[model samples]
Target: MNHWDKFLAPYKQAVEELKIKLKGMRGQFELDSSHSPIEFVTGRVKPIASILDKASQKGIALDQLEEMQDIAGLRMMCQFVDDIHTVVNLLRNRNDFEIVEERDYISHKKTSGYRSYHVVIRYPVQTIHGEKKILAEIQIRTLAMNFWATIEHSLNYKYKGMFPADIHMRLKRAAEAAFRLDEEMSLIRGEIQEAQAFFTRKKELKQEEKN
Candidate 1:
């Protein structure tokens, strides 16, 4: 237990720090009264059980756990598919960490019809002894894509990756439907942002009245 804690401490710290920095990007956009490519950010360090399971499945030795790119994961949800690319570019421009690799699951989806842009980064965390470099994965996707992927992930756990034929077909159909939804929303992105801005100003005025 103590060994596990020590092993995961740097990963946990990396997740927390990255979450704050990513969320801060959205905050900056909000302050500028501009549309943020990032809608929300979420992160986690993989649980010990999940880490062990994945390591076993991948034939990774215990000492080679650092080879696992997603031991610490962060997700940036966007309102539209275009915003996903925008967020990815933003990540590319940041100097806080080095992006080691990228997987364009959105362009070439998985066999299970998953869609997302994954960025693997090598982040350095300052520990008491020295700086520790850890690999973390950042996933960027539109809200519609995220919704479908979340459902698919849950089903994967339920079926243990062996889905019934009917369910598999339905999930593939659902993935297409979600992508269509994202496309439709992108067409009206301007109108949506305008409406959001109007509502935000109205809320600010009401707050001022209360003050």
Candidate 2:
């Protein structure tokens, strides 16, 4: 195995285990025929090249890159604005991890108009040698906000974070629209959650009958 491969093995394991645990939360909500705050979960271990780039950009020494909380990242996408808070609370109550920090970009947004709730956690991973503590970042956001951020991230990549003036202006406007959409969705959240819960019960009934 290469040096990078060996170094990232534990991080990869952390991502996989966390994905299963987080997704299991969604499963529990479904089984209970309740509304799940999380719409979906996704995770990744930052690639070597991206890690190196981030370290260089942030003036982080290579040895200290291990301190980067987002090296192992997981995102929980929610269906409503309030659901973001619900998910964050769930994370806080979990005994498996220790939440060390929280960054409320949703309330105090970014200059680039990004919004998300970020939590830095220390999670224990069982390795052959022993249990190891690893830092991971959990980002929770409404789907609308995620959509805007994904597009902006792609454009930022294309423009190398220095977009032309007009493009930047348009992107900011789009971000506002995305936030508005989230607000509208939140307004009707009760009706939507009821409909989803009803459908879940009906599906479960059908499964019981089939069995």
Candidate 3:
């Protein structure tokens, strides 16, 4: 009954382990800001791998299937670009995981208006029975970038790969705005964090005085 269920177990295992890592990795994106608190939204997109075999059964190639891999994705939408880079660097420094590939789509966006920092890494997860290397893709981007990307993707899927001219222009404009916004936000974040630390110290001092 289960023809290729074996490959599925490892894929599912890999995805589950990745979800756990992403949960723990959430804290890495949060930072105190003097004006406003910064928080990142983490999301995962997982496509059914069984679709691959189904595609093959329908006389489709793996390459074509990859283009159709619009699902099975994860997005870490950050408040600032620095946090995006911070998360990327944090992953790079880790010894427990190895980076298989890195694509800076932020700098080099796709022609279809896609923008995000994508990294493919293999992290070894130790289970009760044994250890396994799970390959997963991590996308780091600012909230603005996510906003633009989401809209464009939705339209693309809706139109079935045919986007109108106005839609394309809007996406480009949004991408530009997102870039500028991320920079401006980064500068403000640094200033606010400094102020927060000062306030925190002041509160600590007052508590000490009462004690």
- For each candidate in turn, the TM-score is 0.98, 0.95, 0.68
The candidate that achieves the highest lDDT relative to the unseen native structure: 1
lDDT of 2 at 145: 90
TM-score for candidate 3: 0.68
Q: Give lDDT: candidate 2, residue 113.
A: 91
Candidate 3 per-residue lDDT, tens place, 51-128, comes to 664576567775554333223345666677767777788779878778888999877888765778998877665667
User: Which residue pairs in candidate 2 have backbone atoms (N, alpha carbon, C) closer than 3 angstroms, thus clashing?
Assistant: none
Give candidate 1 regions above 4 Å deviation: none
CA lDDT, every prediction? 0.95, 0.92, 0.66
Clashing pairs for model 1 are none
Residue 159 deviation, candidate 1, in Å?
0.9
Query: Candidate 2 vs candidate 3: which has greater lDDT?
Result: 2
Question: What shift in Å separates residue 191 of candidate 1 from its native position after superposition?
Answer: 0.8
User: lDDT-based ranking, best first?
Assistant: 1, 2, 3
